[model samples]
Target: MTVLDQRALNRATLARQMLLDRADLPVADAVAHLCGLQAQEPQEPYVGLWSRLRAFDPAVLSDLLVRRRLVRTHLMRRTVHLLAADDVLAWRTRHDAMLRQRVLGVYRGEFDGVDLDELAAAAREVLADGEPRTNAEIVSVLAARWPDPDRRALGEIVLALVPTVQAPPRGLWRTTAGVRTVALARWLGSDADPAGPDGDDPPGRALVRRYLAAFGPAASADLRAWCGLAGLPAAVAAVRDELVAFRDARGRTLLDLPGAPRPDPDTPAPIRFLPAFDNAVLGYHDRSRIIDDAHRNLSVAGARFVLVDGRVAATWTVDEGVVVVTPLRAFTRAERTAAAEEGAALASFLSEGENHRVRVAAG
Candidate 1:
């Protein structure tokens, strides 16, 4: 019955996303809490972590990769994410169907008459030896059996069909490496949970909680957008008794954990730099809390952005050694100073303190 205005939701989003104030939480915990960072670009998570964590050490994230505590895998929405090994192992089974369907949507005609289960078993055979393989290598091995789908699609489909993870060095901090993958079980040393006790969904109820903790005060549509899972209405319904609900300005219902922090609408938010495909902007169907509708496409366009006053105000990229900010709109003097200040820090972090120059493109 309570109504939350856009500013109320905006402050709540910044609080939940750890952007209002940089958090002191551990890197691994931050990754898990944020439901994993969108990591297709690999090195982007370093900047993602740098913006959120206090005293973040890139080496620690690299250590996580080498230690098997973190993994780069195809999971939510079938995009590559840097997730905790435990999370990927626990949640992979739940996302298997979405991953398969998304890849099928792209390659359905080519894969016509192909038996998916048989293909999964065959792909597993290729990865069973514990050696990581590129998508090309895996597709080449399966070419004789299923040659119709091109090599790229064959590898992508197999990655979806079988639980697989891109191996280490691919996502290591400041390290550039090609993607190589092995079975998730081999990498994690265990199989994913088969299904939840409630039904065929594993951790859907828990996902609702986790998602709210990180990106809540959200609608059911937002949850579906975040995880790409359609079968979670039951999961939400099951947890309905435990959650508190509010209506957004648009009159859409928003559900959130009762104890989660919903900061005052006027809480001051800092200028922050976000990586490409950052979940904070991309995790919801209605993204007005952190981004305007007119600028919504930027989130999916892989544009790294600068958050001025907790809203997207500029797009940024590091060129050579300088941080370049191209404002989406004219910035106030104060906003310009904040943007340049944060941009310098990011450049220093990225360039190992050797470069901290920042350039602000007009308007």
Candidate 2:
């Protein structure tokens, strides 16, 4: 098998992630293409889409939320993600067990005697009216039935047990609002699709394909890392015939869709700004393809990064409308110029073309 070195994997990642060249796709399609944007931070998806899409209008994303075309929900890894409504409805059921287990992992002792099925039925009853409710609001009502578990734990398990979407304007572009959730089925006007019989897991198989399309040439471990589902080995096995294989430098088996873009290792990677918790860095078990080992913790620490030559080279933030870039390492004069130029573009995007100032801190 061909051994894909780090640079080879880096370029491939860049291509698959649409960071090598911005895509002209529409906002919802791009969201679907990327699976979804990690959207715990409400305004960050706008910046993420801005970096990937050409002429991305934040209003379109907000409009999608209002129109029920896009939704914010707990899906992969049980984190808040901005997902296409159709994808969420189709994939939400598949994640039900994992979501329950993850919340339990965090609050197991708190839920010792609580019957989760009963809790779910009750929670559904609470949400059945179709009115959006904040977590605290939902939990206060449920606190009467299950006063044993910590309120936080009780609320989290309720959300996991009952598939729910965080309602807008929680995720609306440039809008600051508290999280209010409604039942996923009620919000989308359809129940989440049930798993296929005999444990076929067609959605799991579809996820395997989709992950490779966007983040692939990856290992089974990487796929698991991306989706947080432990049972996809069966899914991978079912689809094994559909994929091509390669080996990473570490000798781990890598899989990819045959026709997916794997650009040349030396492809010129422009400086691109990424949002906190962006999956391009967090989607894999091994992130060395796009981030250095020394800086690996930054990916999970919610630091927005600047990609210099397709690798994380700096962390960025905005202060008083200025895009502030603090280099993680020394940059060449040209790299600095490119980063500033791109940072300016991002600032302008954030400010709606009012401010484009960028400060690249000394080396």
Best candidate, lDDT: 2
User: Model 1: per-residue lDDT, tens digit, 1-363?
Assistant: 999998899899889889999999998999999989999999999999999999999999999999999999988888999998888877888888899999889876878889999999999999998899988888888999898887888888898989988998898878889999899888888998776755545388888999999998999999999889888988898888999999999999999999999999888999999999999999999998889888998899999999998899999987888999999999999999999999999999998889889999999
| Candidate 1 weakest ten by summed lDDT | 193-202
Q: Write the per-residue lDDT of candidate 2 for residues 196-233, one digit (tens) a residue.
A: 74368889889999999999899999998999998788
Poorly placed runs, candidate 2 (over 4 Å): none
Error of 1 at 259 (Å): 0.1
User: Pairs clashing in candidate 2?
Assistant: none
Superposed by TM-score, candidate 1 places the C-alpha of residue 114 at a distance from the truth, in angstroms, of 0.9
Would you estimate the TM-scores of all the predictions?
0.98, 0.99
Model 1 spans with C-alpha error above 4 angstroms: 197-202
- Best by TM-score, which number? 2
On the 0 to 100 scale, the lDDT of residue 103 in model 1 is: 89
State residue 252's C-alpha deviation in candidate 2, in Å.
Answer: 0.5
